[model samples]
Target: MVKDQGLSIVHVCQSMDLVDSVVRRWIKQHEAELEGQPGIGKPLTAEQQRIRQLEAENRQLRADNDPIKKSLGLLCARTEMTYRLIHQLQQKAVPVQQACRVLAVSRAGYYQHRRRGERKADVVASVQLKAAFVASGKSYGSRRLCRALQAQGVIIGRYRVRRLMREAAVRPVWKRKFIHTTDSRHALPVADNVLDRQFDVAAPNRAWVSDITYVRTRQGWLYLAAVMDLFSRKVVGWAMAPTMPAELVASALCMALQQRQPPRGLLLHSDRGSQYASLGYQALLEQHGIVCSMSRKGNCWDNAVMERFFLNLKMERVWQRDYANHGEAQRDIADYIVSFYNCTRLHSTLGYLPPAAYEQKMAAILPIGVSENT
Candidate 1:
């Protein structure tokens, strides 16, 4: 085991706790043993051990970098596995240019392949479908993605879109829901639930729904107050603060008032939180002559549209990150509202059109005076 076989006698002695002579004698007695029968012992010094570890890691890295070495399907099958390979390379920090060059694939062609996923699918349509899904921040499932794809003149079925999503390993993000915190126990005055879950509206500002939700950040919990125009399911106004106060919601209402300037009797509905019930918020609504509507006591379903918006917000954006402070969360939420949700996201209730686009399309066709006042 030592001298004759050229084994590390010192390592054998230390590991087996035997004298070198004893190992030598044992080797002599076991002369019939095949050469290289027992493998070499572990590296003796820490540096040598580290070198061994690095060598193993280097081998793993090489296998990862060379995608074909790990999965033969990457080149030949050339379908879902290809997307997975590109994704794996991306995870390994391999540049897209380098990956395409090594794989002998054109960059544009490879992306088209990766996006479509299945070889049988229409490559262009699949790419467009994936583009829509990704543009929604992976928040649009097959139903919405299909609608978006059709809007772009790429007609595809929902189940087919679902299959492509599975092939691409793409899924919408989901967030854990917290308990509803509407403080309906307050002694403040509350109004009737006039909105009555009638989410569909013919015009932009016939009614609006508002709600308050919280975001967790390192600094503290940041509260978000959003007012959504029911007609278009658009977040017309929003405000964020470290505390849940009447002023937060009032500010959101004020923003909506300034932005829309709808007729005096526009219905504004919200949960019976103390903020919405406060004289300040009520007076702001009164000043604009907006009708006040509240959800039934402890019933979140009454404000379902606004609740859905909050659900979308947390699942798609806020819950995905660990914000260091309220400022970061506030900035991100604002961007999500203005840049994505209002402008780009597809609302199922509005025939898959985004809020802004739906409003614009309606205005283009409907008579001028038939918009808000209706």
Candidate 2:
């Protein structure tokens, strides 16, 4: 209007109630449009405005299609699977809100699904922990229980196992103090300390340690004599009777002889009790060509390995039960030795393997039919 009607630019600004700079900018934009040149800021031409609108729509369309392409087959999958995909996409720098929206899932629902899965996993872990504790006869502490759970394919740590044990209100049996009574002041012949505190034997049947412990039952005291092969710390033989007599120890030695049939020169060490020093027991040792080694007078540490076995027996099994009779105690003790102790218990000395398993594994790796000394 200023160019064709001879109206001044200032007059046009006043008529339109606009500032002078605004009118000047509009005129410059119109001149750029007539010359087919692009101008900055808001486009004054119709074609440029339509082009800007289409560019914005194209950007919005690409943003909407990107998540859809990433979640193609996932849309037909289960809701749980969809949530898992959403989680995976979020980890790969995809926005969770956008992914959930494209997959037709509510953001709150996806979060709730994740929480439910976590709770389920916790429940399964608790159940497995409880089962392992019970299977150990409530005798395993956190270290052993952690190993047990790992063996069962449960990935857990010792601290976590301890926490679970506390939550479940489960605990291992505690050991009690007991006195040792040995009749060592007898006039019977005593052998020298030939074994000499060498508890670690390189092969089975190379060395054996024997000891006797007393168990209380309703039928009075029951004495148990056990023979252990020092190599694997296994109870090779054991005998139980109402009295702690020479015959009881003899029977135990005989059982060990029949089972192992070791070569001559096998060393058998024991405390200098009357039963171990009895004429019959010494003669049996001589007849079998076994070497008899006696511990120092009143020194139990000489037979520390056997002493430890007895301690474990008392603490883990005998002390936990009120035995009604000798037979019951005998059966329970046998089960602990044969089924649990020898077959399943984790021995720290044996690299956390059971006695039987340790022996088997060594047999496979070591030479066949050759003694440790050989």
Candidate 3:
């Protein structure tokens, strides 16, 4: 066979090393038949092989930079294939937990496509818009929805926010979870309501709200509890965990307390979730000398501030982001809450100034004007 094909001494060893003895004997016999063959075993040089591999990698990187290539879903689909191996390993219990650690996908997405039974609706366009909006974590709402739809080159009424949501049955994730967190049923003396749903207040740091939201990641769903200063509509502190333990809620509250150092009687309000109603949570509130209040059970309106925050989180950030693992989800949520939401987000309550900017402006003027107690 070696003689029948173009094979020589060195070429035979390199090509069929598994049968090296046979290959070598064949080559020797062929060589004995003809002492020296013309040109053989002249494969690519080491440098040439390296250059080809490098060029292949460079080509892929360049492809990634081209927006059309990436957005057309060709590049994205190709790139996501790397995750397939991890998923395959997971199927066999390989214990490789990518858990939103490596990816950033919208958890609430119905990207799964087909459901058990298909429900066909005439409003295809509306359905598409709703998917995008919910994918946006409801952050876009009506106005942002209009802008996003326009960007997609679809000229439709802004009112379609509600319409599309209803059609898709994909309402924003945290639309007032009737499942309360704080247990107001306790006999422990509850503090009187001072804020009393009065979200609109002058100046800054006068009022604050707290609530919890959840995000689904590869590891599992991570629950996030946070406290926001209503004056600026900014998140002050937040904690995330694989489990929604009471400490998770209190830790976030403590972080906020240490950071803001609100006045002697800052109003801390939240729902009747046990996390808030527990002795530890209530004690933390009393320790800070702040008044405590709970929204009436089964009432979403009483905690509108937190409800709005949850709505924003579910609709804007969590809806659009997919976490590869738990760490990524936790870290990303922290950035979204602290970096963007608090400092850059425009609050309708603060006359459009971001929470941080609103607070800074208030601190600048509070000594001379707006003499009012929170």
Candidate 4:
């Protein structure tokens, strides 16, 4: 009812269409006036009010989580809080079944975690354990792993990390033995044992040792030959093949040659295997001006450095695991030799220092110009 047209009865519409048109025109006129004014409507509905409250609560929860962002430990603490709250509520009259359901936990798990914070300790132990594990190539059990940690200045109970490793299914890699890979019977010229088990070196590439090992695979067997620097015990070069041949060992020797351009008079040592006895391999040493050193005809002990390397590979890594195929063995062996064994695995012979560490120290202190022939 418009008070502006107080004599309203005089201008009334007679038909429905006219009445509708006049009503619309009046609404349009009022809409313009209402644009800057408060809207005429009922207050918020119950559902609308609940939705607004939920939004505010959500914002507050976000603020609460800000302090613990991306921290699993913080998230775990929150979970524990919920569990504790539910437990307390049950003690104070809530039903047991209801409490467990609301807490989102099994009663046993909640109590177990409370009694032993394994998750937190496990995470920390795992980082340490991994270094030791890789360093030892999974050969060391919890006991040896514990000793390794002690040597590194870490103080933690063996059983504690053992339990965590068990829970995480952490186990040292498996190794196994292989025999009959060596063949020294071929009618080829054998070099003299010039170094004569003298494995110690005054500098890099002074004495290089080479050897062969076999790995079993589904396709059959694979052979790997490696050349190591006696100074660092590093696998300076290695080659893999399904068959034993001169070329196989030659390729590995070539890699060592290219890498170390070792000075003339560098002693190249190996077991009296046919591959090492071959003309191709000897020619390589002669061309590079290297002195050839071979093991005594039937004695493995003559080439002690090569023997020790194989023993470590066998007992510490190979003898502990079974490979489904050659490729897997190759990859794991490569990772062990280059990534862990030489670089970081502690050696008792080197005063528990890793090969790389020992080499770095030697390189820093040793004076230059100490040639091998000197």
Q: What are the per-model C-alpha RMSD values against the true structure?
A: 21.8, 5.4, 25.0, 20.6
Model 1: CA > 4 A from native:
1-128
Model 1, span 247-336: residue lDDT tens: 999989889888988998899999888999999888888888889998888788898888888888888888788999988988899999
What's the lDDT for candidate 4? Answer: 0.76
Off by over 4 Å in 3: 1-190, 367-374
Which candidate number maximizes lDDT? 2
Q: After superposition, which runs of candidate 2 have C-alpha atoms over 4 Å from their true positions?
A: 9-29, 37-62, 65-118, 175-177, 189-197, 368-374
Q: Give the candidate order by descending TM-score.
A: 2, 1, 4, 3
Q: What TM-score, computed on C-alpha atoms, does each candidate reach?
A: 0.66, 0.76, 0.52, 0.58
Ranking by lDDT: 2, 1, 4, 3
Tell me the deviation in Å of residue 227 in model 4. Answer: 0.8
**Residue-level lDDT tens digits of model 3 in 1-374:** 45577666467677656467666655566676586554344479899999999999999877876765456465457435534544565578765434323343332222232121123332656766776665454555565565656657876676765566565664544333333344456655554556678987676566788887777787777788988877667788888888887799899988987787777777788877767777888888778887887776667788888877876766567666778888998887887777767775556577656688887787777766553244
Could you tell me which 10 consecutive residues in candidate 1 have the lowest summed lDDT? 34-43
Model 4 alpha-carbon miss at residue 243, Å: 0.3
Runs in model 4 deviating more than 4 A are 1-131, 141-152, 155-176, 319-322, 371-374
